[model samples]
Each structure stands twice: as structure tokens, then as C-alpha cells.
Target: MDRVFSFQASGVCINTQHHLDALCVYFSDRDQLDSLEFYSDLEASLKSAVLLPDCVVMIASRKFCEDIKEYWSNDVLKASFVTRGERSGKPFIKYYYLYCWETSGLVEVFSHCADADVKPCFNLSICDLVQQGLYHLVKENNVVQIAPVGHLFKHPSGTRNNIFIQARELAKTEPELCFVGRSISLAFGFERFAKLSVVYIDSMGIYHFVQEALSFCKVDARIHSFHSYDEMRKLTPPPIEHLIVISASTSGGMARDLRNDQGFSDSRILTLIDKSDSDRSGKVLIALESVDKNIFDFEADNFETEIELVGEHFSSKAKPPRAVTLGRPHTPPKLLKFLKEFGRDGLNSLNEIIDGQPKVLSLVTEKVSRNKVFLKWLEEEVSWNITVAIDTVICTDDLGSIEIANTVADLISTHKVGSARPTVCVYRNVDWSSVSNATGVLVVTAVARDGGLLREISRDLRENLNSEINCPRHYLTAVGLPQSKETWSRLKQFLERNASERLYGFSEWLVLPIGSDRQSNHWSDLAALAKTSQVVEVESSVVSKSVVDASLDLVSDAIRKGFNGFLPKTDGSDLALSSGFIYFGDVFKDDLESALHATSYLAIASALQKARDIDDVANQLRSTGYESVILSPECFLRFNDNILHACILRGCRKGELDYSSSPHHSKLMGEFLLKVFSRHQLPYGAAAVEFAAALATQRLKLKKNDQERLVGKVVNSLKDEPSALLGLLLMVDLPRVSMLSIK
Candidate 1:
């Protein structure tokens, strides 16, 4: 065997060149320096030194020597030497160390023989050394004979502390092991070896630190950490062959229990007790079935020495078994059934799935509003705590849509009594911008003339609303309400032709005659349908008075029941009715102006009655002699009718209320008109007289035959107002009397 030697330089400071020179002299040949590998970077020759063919030499630091002694002791020998170097450019002496080993033990064992006898010794091998007990081969061609520089026969502290080394040795044959402790140091030592499957059990609190330390060291091992024994028990144990119990005190019972109860019966158990404990023994004796085992104290021994012993023992044992696989246990049938019934497939089964999993049923049916079946089911099967049902109604007409929307909105707002059973939301037209992105049921009502419009709305909802709504069980429904049979037929054809392709592309569409006698039945069906639906959508024409009224009635009923209410469109039919009044007034002029005045007066009276303060203000004004200021019925009707007509015209031209102009002015004008109309009523004769005067005024602008025809109609309307008709005829002849001057 080829002999190798290692030298460790230890001092405050040492010179590389001087050490090399001294080494050359000691070896008696300058070429022997070629075998040295130096640790310093100062000398190029030393830095680049290569090993000799026969012997290998290395110069390293004391720390490196200690490390080598710990791990590679079987392959290396260590010793120390003192040398001289320059301190501040003067001569200084320092201690240098060395570690050496024989590459081939045969040559060293037979070195006393001459060159001629060297060939005979070539037949000798490492097996012969092991039998002689003069040397031991840790592995093939690796011999360890020399005692390390600081080898301990017994712990100086009188405690047998060699568990780390013993544990490491055991690990070589049993790579799968369990460690029961909170000692970070033990984990650090254990992580150094690769291909280890280690289960580390500690109190829950320190598991984080252990994981952090392992991460810091970049440990590559199969490691499972648990905070409690129960947590550890939950895991399928790897094929454990060793158990290391590290504790602050000697607890042999823990080790024995882990070995017997944790399916680690075949595993070897090792205990390492901390030295600081009062009951700790120098060498703990554990009672086993077959023998008394000795547990070691780990604090009294040097960590590196222990490591060396373990490394030697590891090299001597057979390779560890392959890692054990940990797999998930089979799930119970009951749990599997519950998961299957509560998952995506179950939702399609609808109410049937709610039979067994009542908790899941609660999640779907809780707070359901307007859906009677769901509410009734909840009341009977679940809890009466299901207090409110929310219904969403949408009006989808372009004409008079806002008025219907406002009416529905107002009804919903006012109908909310304390804790009503159901609440409702009426969206005039679907304002995609205002829709919430929250996950829930959405009911959409779309009223469109053609299937193309319905399809467009559906596409918009899909693009803007569907993906944004995160609720898994949500549904979308569209309802079409047509006024007449012709319209209903046209709508039905459009829906049938394009529903699947367009309307049903996103949701289901239903067509119903809203103004028909079955309106209540349709709503009742809808309420029941809502129970099964996550979202409910009803599409109806805003212009359909029956549809609007029916939607409002449903919302009102819900509110009256004291349910939670949400109405986005919260104004009465004032806008629509007022607009209608204006339309009729413009067409009929003075002839129907009295009727429009009566409607406006009634609206004001209704508003006053609802708002007591406003009513009181009106009462106070009447009591202050304001009634004396009231104008005659004809003049009052003409003046306010002109204001109403102008306001309507402004709204028609601009498509919105001009609060700063006509509408605002009309409001103030209405207050005055209300005061007059409240105090007096226009009789049929006065209305007819006003109509005749208005016709007479228009006759002045017509041709000869047109004037005669207009006079005939005025005479017929004023049969009981001959005096008023004569006054109108007189006024018609006055070329200077302008119609505008009448007001």
C-alpha cells in the first residue's frame, strides 16, 4: 500500500515558503516537496504542488485536520510539527500539524524489506491486515490503524456520550429512522448524510425553527416533521429501522414505547439524555426484553470525535434499504358519498340532492326570497330563520321604460315593512355598469321587440356579467311579455327561432302574456321556480302596463311581508303618468287640459298626504287667505297646461329632464296650479266653454271652409255654453287678440 501523510499548519501566522523548505529537508529530498499540497496561496510552487507517485502529502489548517479526522479518519493519519517563520520580517517559531495515511497498507506494512523483497510483498492485500488486527480496512483499499490525535478512551466528564456517533453508525444500515426531540443540533448532525428518511417529532412550537434550520443548510433528505405525537401517528410510517430518542432527561420508557407501539419493533432504539438533568446517569441502563441497553449522555463528548466513530461504523455496515413509500389511506364510503352528493354533479340533481346533506341544503336555500317552494321547504325541513326572500325584476322596454322602472322601484322601496318575508329589486333596464361582480343568483328581465335585441343583451350579459359572477349555482332567465296576440305570436316565433342560438346561449327564456288574467299564476310559478335557481331573470316590455303593474304588485307584496328590500329604481309612476298627461294635453289642447289638471292635482294631493310636512304647509297656506288668490278654472287649467306641455316637449327633445329650464319651472308652476285646483272644481259647462273658446281662437288661422267647419264643431261642443260661444266668435274677429294672450 502507498503511504500518505498530512501536515496541518497551526499558529498565529506561518510562512508557506519556510514550511516547504523545512519539509524538503525533513524528507531528505527536494523532489519530495512535489508530494505536498499546501493550503496557502502565497507560494505558486506550493499552491500548485502535486502528489508523489508513491506517497500523498497534504498541508491544511487545524480545522481542516479536525474535520478530516472526523469523517475520513479511516483513510488518513494526523500529526503535528513546529516550524519557524518571519514575524515583522524577523525570525519566529510556530506550531504546524500534519495528517497522513497509507494509500496501500501492503507497502507500509512491509517497508522494512529491501527493494528486491518489495515484489514479494505485492501479493499481500487489505484482508490480511484485518485478520492480524494490526490494521482495519473501513472499505476496499482504505485502512485505519492509527489512533486520532485526541482520541478519547472514556468521556472525561465521567459520562458515556457517544450516541451521535452510534446513531450515525446505525443510520448506515438503517437509513429510515425516527427522531423524538426538539434538539436542533441533533437535526443538524442527522441532515449531513444523504438518502436518509428522518421523521422528526417535536413540540408544535419548535417545528418551524427545525424546518428553517434544515432549509438554511439545504438538507437533501426525506424529512417529515410533526408537532405532536398524534400528528406523527397520523402519518403512515416509513420503513423505520432505527429510533433516536433525544431528551433533556433520561426517559427510557419513551424509547421503549416508541419501539413497541409505533410499529418500530424491529428498529434499534438509542437514547441520548442531556447532561444537565439531575436524574441523568453517566450511562443510562434501559431494560429491554432480551438485555439491558446503555443510553449515552451526549453533552460530555466532542461532536467531531463522535462523528468519526459513527463514520467508521457506517463504513463497516451493509448499505441501507431503499426508502419506504408513504401513500394516502383509502377514504371512507360515507365521506366519499357526502363529497359526491355535494359536488358539481349534485347541483344538477337540484332538490333531490338536498335530502341527505341538510347543511349543504341550507347553503343553497338560505335567505331565499320570492321562491315559495324553497321558502316552504326551508320552513318545514330547515329553520324558520330564513326570514327574507329577494326577487330581482327587470323591465326591458325602450319606450316609457324609465317610468315603469321608477314605479317598480318606488313600490319596492315603500313596501319594505319591518322584517318582511320577501324583498325585491327592480332594475328598469339592465345597466351592465351597475351590476355587482359578487357571486350570487341574478334575475334578468329583458323586453325586446326582436330576437336580435334579446341575443345582443344575452351576449352582453355573458361578456360582462357571467364570468364576473363567481357563484357556482347561479342561473339566468329571460321573460318576454307581449301585449297582443299578434305581438305574442311574433315574439314566440322570434324566441323559438333564435332562443337556443341566441337567448338560450347564456340562459333560458320564457314568454308570457302579462296583461292576461293568468298574470298572478305566472308570478306564483316564477316564485316557485326561483327556489331552485341561483339567479332569476324576467324580461318584459317597459311599455306593457300589465307587466309593469304585475312586477310592482309582486315587489309590493314582498315588502308588505317585512322582507329585506332593494329597489334601484325608486320613484312612483309620476314620470310616466306626467309624461302621458303632457302628451294628451298637447293633442287635445284646452279640450283635455282639465283632465290633465285633475290628474296633476291628484298626484300632488297624494304626495302631500304621504309627506305630512308638505301637506301641513299646504294647509297653512290655505288658512292664510291664499284661497282668495286662486284663478278661475279655465285660466288655471290653460296656464298650467301650457307649462306642462312645454316641460314634456323639453323632455321629448332632450331625452332627459332639464331641471334648470322647463321641468324645474313646471314644478314651481305645478305648486301654484295644485293650490288653485284644490280649492275649486271645473264643472262640465266650464270645460266645454273653454274648449269652444280654444276652437274659436284656432278658426281665425284657418281658411274659409276650414273656419266654417271648426265653428260647427265649437257650436256642438258648446251647446250648453252659447254665451261662451258668442264670446269666442267675438274674440275670433279681433285680429289683435293672440291665442298666447288668453293665458
Candidate 2:
């Protein structure tokens, strides 16, 4: 089945002795998953099997052997630790699974726990079942490809066949919210209600989103949410509004009442019935006609209040991203001009830095790709970071240069310093599935190393993958001849015949660099080019019409390189650490809130890590802000004042604070405000004036009382007006309105 999912970097390890020990045992247990023979002498059995991919021997007694399967998973490296006998004191048995592919020619071992002295007792009986040994068996069995691909599919070995089991059934499923309105604007705004109510909708997500949205606007709102019809009937239900939102299964009087009631005659209630209206509505305007807000706000926000909801949204890395703020939908010429300047460089630098205009100019002259232009524009136009972890074959030995096979197994592969990574690992030698209790996937080429397939099994998760989202593990292998200059003449013909999964497991296609002189060298050239070249952002609308740009680095390691991340370990609560922004999309769908939390943490971390580098901070936060969270001077100062010392260095003019480096972070700041305003849509005048002042790297000229008056005028302008979040932002200063008003 074709599956789509978002996954983050799960775990990372440093190349150290202690870490190696842990990994050794982790891979060894993988080797023993298939079969293990019983033995009368436990110590002798363990000593004999210690060097095998899995160490399955008894240190205590034969009773421990049967129960060992309980602990068998992709997580633990150390299989078991026990005393030699009832009389023996300290534990002597140390069994672990080590991935031998990473070891070029040296003897290696992997184990759990950081203990360093554990030794492996080698025996030939154990080696026969090793993954390296299994590759020979699979070749002999004539089921090499089909056997590994079957690992990802959930099948009852005894009874069921091809009965598809979905990941949704395994975890807590939150059905998508359905708050349909007359226009997209309303749909976008109402989503914020979910978190504010904190209503647990195991399936339907409409509960708390509504409440959270109101809170963003500093309004107190509540959700009288119900799980079932019986529960909903008990609550004093409010009159149905003209437009309402509900799940698909829920219909009947509830919807009719909303449409029939004179009060809700024109109201249109959005119901989540099918995937037809799946797109999220971004901006919304709700008319308030009654003082009885008991329907929404139990005590506050009476008839006098008008609720407006906006969303934090931006196009996919368009050039001059500010040109398309929530305020309006047209792309201004000035923005076009800025994009033209930004795109002078050709490297796709979505979230990367480029020094000196001259070098950038040279690259543009050499050549340009659409992705290169888009990435360059995004980097220059928006406060966003982009990370793309592509699978490439730098060095190939074990297979037909299937580097993606190694790359896709990153959840199971170990990163070792001063180690050579082959294009592919042994089939079962390093591949294993159904480990750690989470669905896992792997891929392999025709070349064989025994234990590769066993090493990649990782369905057993330390903590069950998040139930809120659905992501299953799958393994794909690309089958073909060697990629070389000699194969260029027949490359296209070969690819057309080989793309079929009937022969392998996944969609098999080769990525070739456009400028390449030969077709067969396409993947090689592109991979090398991506690795070393400086990426530059570009700006442009989608080639066909108005759509998100193509090179919208949705998930790239370069962007999420360094930040504290949350991982679901068996311990449950996130194993939070400074893990360089590992994103697990399988567990969490990345939304504006997650983006804010991550951006804030990264900004704070970067600031604290290099307190002296004002320039670096300025550079990292280049361009503009986001629509997800507010990052104005006031907000940033309020949230992160501890890390930011008051700007003591005076500028050339009095009252003008000057930093040793650029203090302007328009892109980053833009990202923050865009998100917050999308939900809150705060008005402007004095506070807005003050924020704009920061954007321009200037000081506010208005006095304290006057500042309040200006702020009030800006805010009151929005009191009753319904506008998009971007509309609210672009009107911040009224394009010289403040200056004219002050004059």
C-alpha cells in the first residue's frame, strides 16, 4: 500500500566506546529473532553464541531462556545480564547484538548498558545463524527480496493473510476537525478552539482547537464538547449558528436546528463527514448578536464582543514571502523586485547562508535549477530554516549502489566517526523488523552480507509511537545494474523496466542532475552536488498557477539541526534533550504550535550558546517573521528576557540602542508574528508602531501617553472589522499613516 507519513530523527549517538557497547548488544538480539536451539549447559551455550549477531545463552538457568522473547526488541543492545548460578554473586552472562556492517574488518561487539568490560566468547555454532550467514541461506532459499519486504506488513503468521491492519487502530486516533464555514477565512480561524477547551476528542479534533484560538486573541472562550450523542444531549446546547462544524457521523436535529433556528437561519455549520472538504479553513469572521455567551464564553465576552479568528500561514518558500502576508493575496512589484535580487544566486539555499554577493553572482552565471531558485528565495525572504536529508551513495561496495537502502534505515543505523559507510549493508546482517514495538521498514539491493536484514528490524519501540497520528514502517529496495558512465546509453531503458515493485519492494527511480553530461551518472552527480554546494533560496509562484513553491523544504536536517527534541521512550514522557531538532512526524503532525515551540527554543538556545556573537544571532534570524507565533520586541522581551540583556550600546543617536552586529531579524520575527496574528489578529497604532520600529531597527519617537493613544487607534480599527491575519499585520503602520497622524 502507498503510505504517507512524517517522521523525525528518533535518536542520535556519539562515536564513543560506551555508545559502541550499547549498539553492539542492540543489533545482536536482532540476529536471534528467527530461531534458537535449547541446550543443557547454559554457560556453554552463551559462550558459544556470544559472537553471533544475537547472544542467546543462559547465565542463571534454563528457565530464563523461554522468557527472553519478552525483552526481544530493536531497542536493547544487551540481551541479558545474570549470575552464573544461584550461589554465584555478580552477574556473568552479558549478551548483546552488534551490527557488523559498520565494522570494515575489525572484531566488534554491541551491548546495552554503558559497562565496557563485557567480553564476547566466540563459537562457530552461533556464527552459522548470523545475518551474514543468513544472506547465504536466503540466496540458497531463492526468497531474498520477498522475505525482507514482508517484514513491514502486519500479518498473523497462523491465521490471517493480507488482512490489512492500519496504524490508526494501534494508537489513539484524533479524527480531523470539521468546522466548515461559508469561506476559507472562517475555517482557518475556528481551528484555534481545540486547545483552548482542552476537550479530549479521541477521534474528532474540533474540541480544544476552538478554545485555544480564542485564548490566542486574549479572549476567554470555552468548548461545551461532548464525545457521544448521549453526552451532548445532556449539556444545555446553544442555538445552532448559521454555519456549524461537526464530524461526519454526527447529523440529524443538531444540524437542522442550526439551519432552521431564526437566530441561526443563515448560519452554515461545517461537518466532517468525508475527505471531500478536507482542506483547513484559515480565516473566519463570526457575528455575535447576543449577550448570552454562555454558549461560548460561560462568564466573559458578552454580546459586546465580536470574535474574529485568523491563522498563521505563508506560501511554500516564495520569494519576497512578505509580499504575500495574511493581509492581502496579491504579490506586489516591490516584493518581486526583492525576489529578483535574492535569486541572483543559483544554489538551493533554503535555510543556508551565502557570503559575499560576488560568489553568489558567479553561481547564477554557471547554471540554475528551479529548486535552487526557490530555496534561495525562501532563505532570503522568510525567517525559516530548511532541512533535507537525502539518501546518496558516496561509497558503494555491498550492493548495486543503493545508498537509499542505508539512508532509509537511519532509525536503525549507527553513525560512527572514522568509519566507512557502504552503499548497502548485508541483507539480514543488519536488518531486523518488528522490534521495539513500533512498525519498522528496510530496503536492500542484490548484493549480500548475511546479517544486514536482521539489523534493520525496529518495530519494537521504546515507547509506542504517538496514537494521534498514523505512520507505518516500510522497506524498499531498488534493483538495477551498477550506475556508471558505461550504462548511460541504456539508462532510461533500464530504469523503465526496473521501476516495478513486482521485482523489488518500492517505486524505483533514479534522480539525475539536470546539467549532467551523461544520464546514468544523474544520481551520483546530484548527490555529490547537494552534499557540498552552498544552497541559495529563490522566489517564484508555482509554474502552473498560484500554489506553494516546489522547493519548499518541508523537512530538512539543515533547518532542524540543533534544538531540544521530544522522543517517546518506554518511560513515556518525552525524553527531552538538546538533540538538534529531531522531528518525529509519525508521532506528531508539525503544525504552527509545534513550529513556535521549536523556533522559540532554538532562538533561545542559539542566543545562550554564543552570547557574544550578536552578528551570528542576527544572521541566523535574517529576513522576516512567521504567522504562527508573535515575536515582537515586547513578546520576545517578555518571553526570553533572561537571555537578552538590555541593549546597553547606544546607537549614533541618543535613545537608539545599537548592537555590535545587526539586530534586525525580520524573517524570524515575521514567522513568529504571522502565526500569532493568524490566530489573534492584534491591531496596530502605538504597540504596532513600536514593533515596526524594531523591524526597521529604529526607536519609537512617540512618548508614553502618545504611544498609548497610537496603539489604541490601531487596535480599535480592528475592534469590529473582520480581516485576514495577514491583512491585520500589513496594516501595522498604515504605510506612513502613523507619521501623518502624529504630524
Candidate 3:
């Protein structure tokens, strides 16, 4: 296996040296979209794009953010660069670049990443530095300014830092970035922009004080934030230009706080709030850069009203509003609850109960003390609902009691859901279980037999039920215990009927008992006339008849049910889910998303649960058509009543894990599945054959030297069939990297 488990095999890498000498960042003057047919507009850019093979930077746009957000459900992968280069007299360097896209192309235009607000160039305000390329690396006081267009003059900007600014003229270009009164600047205390003349103090007092403040200022300083809802409610809509409003304090609203004045709107709000609190009361929302925005939308519209409703609803739901925000899980309450609830369990393991159950249903006779025996008075037995009632019978007859128990057992049998399940009987060694159909008919009845005839049939039945099915089935025994001779006769007849139903008249089969409950250890005493329960055998080689044809008829009816369940009879207009969803994901393809897969499987289960006249849960399961090849551990744990935690372990032969452990077809499947894993960001420990295969596909990308280490780690985590695993490992060698076709 190249690698299988994500957590285990994740750390191998090949350290390759520098491939390119200079970085070649390709930036287009237009926005480019990422699409499925083409990786990006950069695909063509990559061809003639890389004049510098050592470094490559492909420009991105807002669309890059949109497409990735829509399509990526698992994890967002930061981009990587693959380079193969050689320096003269130096060994070749082969590596890939991996980093943030935030500060790449625009920054690379000049020595420093260009600020979006500073167009053309940051030093463009001065005409001399506009048309030139200059690099200055000078000391703090010994200053100099050399422009490509003019004579050397004293540098007007004076500072020892990376850039200097002597702002005494201070009033030349009007400051587009400004803050106003009582709407204090969240950072550096107050708005210091010298051109900032008009100011509004606070949004809370704005309704009462705005006109007075506006009368005093030479220029109308635009109002930024609106704090009180009542204040904003009273103000007339401002001119429909972009404007800012600190609608609420950090102590109040979510979008209120503005940590900085960089928002790009021509006018936008910089709301103040306490920086320490993590909730809405603590965070700030500031315009990165002000742009033209409809001034009426925020000032007098219902925007904040809607936001407040959602926030209140979110709080009520014990959830956070996720549309425009991220709220953390309720960790504090959960942690405290965990500690308080489990301290006792952690400190004491011995107080728990543990016991083992038996495997077969057989009868044995043993001596018992008088006090230990359970004696019942013949006449004083109370009228009780504890025992079932049907057809006006108290089940005093042996066959009738058997029929009643058998009805419940058969009900359970039909509940198979799909496959055979274990059945247990604690009293007798002859425990066994049988398949249930829609219903259980009386297999045999003492009402149908007379004397010794019923006993003979039961004798034969008791033999077959014990040896087959390995399940220690339920036993309804009657031995030395008190019972009327009529009940005894009925019991024998019940056994005879069941024996006949198990096999064809001319054939034989393995049999196991089917019982319902157990008391202490008195099985033989209740089921036998004497001590010799085992030695009392009937004709061993016997053939009993069955109603298989009738059973097959039921199955045929079930087929219609299954088909109806698979492809619902409703018009296509209301298809419960896709056809693929009904198929239990046998069609769960490599390209399918996990969310889609889960929804599909759940759809099938939901539909099955909705059928008409369906009462036998066990039989319905037995007849269910869909099956799963792999299950998430979570699914297994969550639906333990239904799914199996099945894992097939495979040991490696030489360096590759054996793939032969699973059915041969799984090998064919693994080959393609590996490619899917390589292409997506799948999680660790999911139980999918494709998961392991796909993980190997990813491992092949690790540095060659790290191959063994990564592969070894993954192997330790997986428990798969040897042959299946070996077959999966074989896929890693099946041309992992395709050679590009020379155009």
C-alpha cells in the first residue's frame, strides 16, 4: 500500500531543491473564471506562461473565491507549484511551491505587493517618481532621493523606516478616508486626517445633534455610523452616496464594530466595539475600502431589522447564524457536563455487570431442593395479560401454547431485514432460530393428534432442532412438572407440526429451536416426562414436508414490494429521491461526494420504512434489496442495530499489502477508486475500499525518499482483507503519474 489511512500516512515528503531562479508572476488586467472544462484561464497561461520555469504565479480573481467556495465541501487546498530546474554545476532541484494566494500577483507587480487603493504606483503623487523604477536602501539620517526624471533634491519625506512621510503640507489632497465626531475612530483613538472637517459625535445623539454639528462645520463631514435604532429611525435618508453608519456599539451589534478605516466603499460605517469579547459585543466591522453604495439601503431600510430577527432566532435555536458569520460550538457546557457525568464511571470499573450466554438449546434433568422449586397452585393462578390471548384460549393445550410462541417467533423471523440473525434460548442446550415470513401458522397442534402418535413426531423434531443452526434457540419445555395429560398431548402435537414444516416429506435439513424467554435452570424438568431427554430419539433419518411453494409465493409478493420500494410508483413529479439513492449507492461512484452518498443511502432506508401493511420489521429487513460494501465507523456505531462493523485484515507480502483477501472484483474497483482519493480531500478512518485506494494515489505524490515511511504508517492503520489489500497495493504501481503528451 502506498498509503491508506489519512492520519497515519500523511507525513512523507521529498525535499527538492530550488527549481527556478526568479519568480515569474503572471497577472492579467481582466478577471478570469475557474471552470470544469478548463482548470482556469491560467491553463493556457501555463503553456507560454512560464518563461521562468523556476517560479510561477497565476493571477486569480473574485471568481476564484466564488467557485472554490461553492464546490469545496471537505477542505480547501492551498495551491502548489511543481518545478524541475538545474543550476549550472549544481544538482537538479525538483519541488513544488505551496502558500497563500492573498498576497501574490498584485504585490509582485513591483518590489512590494501593490496596495489596491494606491493605483499605478504609491509614489505617483510626486511627478518625478511617477515614470521611473528606483530602489532605495538608505540609512535613517543620511538621506537621499534620486528620481529617474529629476535632479537629486532633499527627500521631502523624512523617516528612518521602510517609507517616510513629512505631512506638514497636510492639506493638499482631500482625505477620502475619514472619520467624524462622537463616532470616534476605533483605532489610534480619534480620526487624525487633517482634511477631516465635519464630524458627528455619536449615532446615539445624532437625531438630536446632527443639524447643530453640520451648521458649525465648513465642509459637511459625512456621517459614518448609526448607533441607536431610534436615532436611525428619525433621520431623513441621506443623499444616495456610499455612507458609513456605526449603527451600534461593540457592546450591542454584530456588524457594528469597525476596527479600521480601510473599507473600500466611497462611504461606509466604522462601528466601535470592545476588541476583547468574541461575540457580537466584542467584534468590529469596518469598511476595507469604501465604494459607491446605495445610501438608502442601510440608513432607512429594513436591513438591520432582518439581521436582528435572524440573530434572535439563532439564539433561541441554540445555534449561531451561519449565513454571514461563524459561531463556535457550545464547548463550555458540554465539557462541564462530561466531567460531572463520568467521574464515577472513570473511578470504578468493577461495579459493572458481566456475564456469558450459552450457544445451544438442549434439555437435562437434575435434582432440585424443595425450596428451590417453583410450585404453583392449580386453581389460584390469576387471570393475567402477561400470557397472550388468541381465539378465546388460555393455551392450556401444549400445541396451542407452541402456536402462540411460534406466532411471536415467526413475527421475529420475518424481521430478518435482510440476513439471518442470532436467536438464543438460555434454558435448553437445543437453542436455535429460523427465518420468519409475513406470519407464523400453527406448525403442529395436539388437537390434531391423539396419544403416542404426537410423541413420535416430536421425538423426531427434537433431534434435528438441536444439531443445526448453532443458535441455542428458545425452548418451551414440559417434563416432570405438573400439566394435564391433555396439555402433554397437545405439546407433542406442536413439536410434530414444526418438524413437518422444516423439510420436504422426502428430505432432511439442519434444525435449531426457536424460543422466547428463560428462567433459571429447569429446562429438562419442564420439557420431559422422565430423566432421559437426550436418549429419547425418534427415527434419525427422517423426511418432513414443508410449504416452500407457499413461502415462494410470499417471496414473489415481496418482490413486488421490493420493486415498489426501489422505484416508487408515484409519478416522476414527486420522485422521493434519485434512482441512485434507491439503489443503496451500489452506484456510489468514485466521483460522488460523501454528503451526496449519505443522503442517498438514508433516502433508501426512509422509503423502505414507508410501505403499506408492513408490520414485521425483521421480515422487511430480510427482503430489503440494498446492501453496503463499506460503512463509516460513525454509521456503524449510530445504526448498530442494522449495520455490521466488518473489517477484513490483510498482511503485506514483501512491500505491498495483499489485495487477494476480498472478492476478485473489488481489485478492479480499487484501481479506479485510488484515483478519486488522490483528487479529493477525504477524511481519515472512513470505511471505504476506495478511501484506501485513493489514499495510495495521494501517497505517490510524496517525496520519493518518504515513500516507505508514509506507506508504513498507513499500513499500520488499516485492517483489510490480505488479497484485497494486496490488489489495492498493486494499483499504486499501475502508472501513478501519466507522462504528458508532447504537443
As a whole number from 0 to 100, the lDDT of residue 206 in candidate 2 is 43
lDDT per residue (tens digit) for residues 414-527 in model 2: 332333332333433432232222222233332111213322222221133344323232222232212222242243333223222432112222211111112222122222
Model 3 spans > 4 angstroms off: 1-243, 246-708, 712-723, 732-743
TM-score of each: 0.16, 0.18, 0.16
User: Which segments of model 1 are wrong by more than 4 Å?
Assistant: 1-443, 446-455, 461-743
Lowest lDDT 10-mer window, candidate 2?
Answer: 1-10
Q: Write the per-residue lDDT of candidate 3 for residues 640-681, one digit (tens) a residue.
A: 211111111010011112222223323433443333223222
Model 1: which ten-residue window has the lowest total lDDT? 171-180
Better of 1 and 2 by lDDT: 1
What TM value does model 2 have? 0.18
| Candidate 2 CA-lDDT value | 0.25
Candidate 3 TM-score over all chains jointly: 0.16
Q: For model 1, how does the per-residue alpha-carbon lDDT over 420-484 read when each residue is reduced to its tens digit?
A: 22222334345555543423223333333224444454345456654634322112222333332
Give candidate 3's error at residue 27 in angstroms: 55
Prediction RMSDs, each to the true structure? 37.6, 27.9, 35.0
